[model samples]
Target: MAKEKLNYIHIIVTVYVLQLGVDMFRMSNMLAEDFGTNGWIAILIVSIFVVGIIYTIGLVYRLGEGKSIFEILENHLPKFMLYPFYLGVAVLWTLIGTFIGKHYIFVLQMLSFPTTSQSIFNGMLIFLAIILFSMGIYNMVKAATIFFFFTVWTIFVVAFYLPEFEFIRLTTHFFSGGDGYIKGFYRVFVTFFGFELVLLLFPYMQKNTPVFKATLIGHLLLTSAYVIASIVCFGVFSLYQLKYLLVPGLELLSYIELPFVERVESLIFNLFIGEVIVSIGFYFWGAQEMLIRLFRKHSKAKKAKKLTLALIAGIFVYSMQFDTLIQVHEMLHKLSLFHTAVIFGLPIVLLSLLFWEKRKEKKSNAKSI
Candidate 1:
């Protein structure tokens, strides 16, 4: 049976919501701290590489030939050989989702509710993610699409800061240093990392939809928005100032003085809650889907989803103990190597193997004919 599939807009929303959360919340500051004046350069370089990765993922999606990647791989490869890769993806996204939830809860604690217990927020969020995942892909993507318009106006708020921006602040040396640039690149790479969701999500997209074009267009939009926000932050703050701030984009928002509002950033932060939910929801969904593949072989769908949700929520709550924001950043920095190997390297290797196998299979059929 043909599975229900998402249109291009849903795909775009899925990608958009996936990338917008922790990345948009804190990435500009990380870039500024690492590359200083050359932050934008680091972003541009990484974005080009990420776009190529997305394009390749779209190609791999077609190789699924109407099945999910898990189904395709399971049908063709030995279970022992394929299950580890599936487990790696499941673990990677689960950890990423956990960290994002923890980080945002910590941020909220820092900004608004110092007296509130983070464990409460963490539990609530994981519970919320599980409920959303149970609703299935179409509802999740629909949620992403609706939340986007609620948050879209915040992009234009960057414009309000333009008059205060001193273009000379952007005049620092282009190459801060090769070493520093590389460090900046790695930090920014984490921000750009979520687009690879397309690999896992391919089968869910409508068969007739232009997955490549939709992902590319969606990425272009995401990239442009982040670049503009990063540049705006760079232009508004000196290197010394930018390096110390936790969320420079929020700082940009703090400057706005509306007739009725006292702090525009506070309002913006609340609006961003929807984005955070959608982003984390996608990861939880990805993790749950991978679990179904590993434990259920895609059968017993209802039972698998329930078990996956409980396992994820339990892990998320347990991991939130005594985790400070600095600790979270340091932990993510150390985990980058593992992330690169599993999330980035494994896909490329798998794509090559799939292409080779398909070509050989085609040749074999031609010979038989």
Candidate 2:
């Protein structure tokens, strides 16, 4: 039997789930630091650009006519020239994906496994990602679909803070707080990073798939989640406290009380494990697929699987040097710059190439006539 293709809903859920990574833990805090009172406005501003990015991605899909990014570039460029670029991007994705998982492990260590060595959790996370990637994109989407329900509830948890949410705490200052406006914008913009990976999913969709609709829906959902989180935190905490709090979202959840259970943030944090896993799996799969394309080993299943294992092992070994969350934070801070470059740069480059290719073909046809 032939494998199943992704439908509209699968793509929507994937975009929503994947775009929301460990970033949620701290997005509100970033907004507070950068844009004091009603900093959630920054999220809305960044989202306008994100909508443009998604629209540009949609243009790439229409122009490419149902091809993955690698396929489009490889069609027009020589492997000798393109493979080097491919290798560089694959390595970048590998590092970003690996460390993203590693960053989550670092936080998990502080939250629940203060004494346990991180090697165990890091290894398990990567291993789980490998397994998910091995199942291929189709199965991975289905799995993320299930996990979507698992973590989506956390978005609604903001309602619990309403009683304590005082509008007076939300000062009228428009864009009050800031270490630097540009850096704050960058931090909030990074939350939407993973949606760019959807450019690779075109080849997996069926002919009738309403991909851009799904993409827009998913992107909007993630924006709402972040913006709502920002509003809740702004209402509940003073600007000083919001700026200092590392992750106001998690801290807010940590305050929830119930007759049967106390300190349920840890339990809720466990639910996020599924989201983190799905996000990492997509990134790792992106890396692995890029490597496979670069090496011309796309047909060799065993070799591709081994390549994934090697990537996973290499990432784990690389992660061991980190003994502090500060180190991971610093490293990720640097990586996000490169990650942002690709998120915007790649699509624009592809669109330019596609347009250039069309113009060249038009010239050839004119000469032939």
Estimated TM-score per prediction? 0.92, 0.95
Model 1 TM-score, all chains together: 0.92
lDDT of 2: 0.83
lDDT of candidate 1 over 118-180, digit per residue (tens): 888877877777677678878988888888888877788887877888889888588562337
Q: How much lDDT does each candidate structure score?
A: 0.75, 0.83
Against the true structure, candidate 1 has what lDDT? 0.75
lDDT of residue 304 for candidate 2: 60
Residue-level lDDT for 289 in candidate 1: 81
For lDDT, the strongest prediction is 2
Q: Please give, for residues 1-369, the per-residue lDDT of candidate 2 as tens digits.
A: 976788888888999988888778788788877777788899999999899999988888888787788877877778887777766777777787778888888878777889988878887887888788778898899989999998888778788888999988887778876677898888888778789889889988987577678899999998888888888988998889888988777888888988886767787788888878888888888877777775475577467657767866776798789878889888888888888888878899899989998899999999999
For residue 52, what is the lDDT in candidate 2? 91
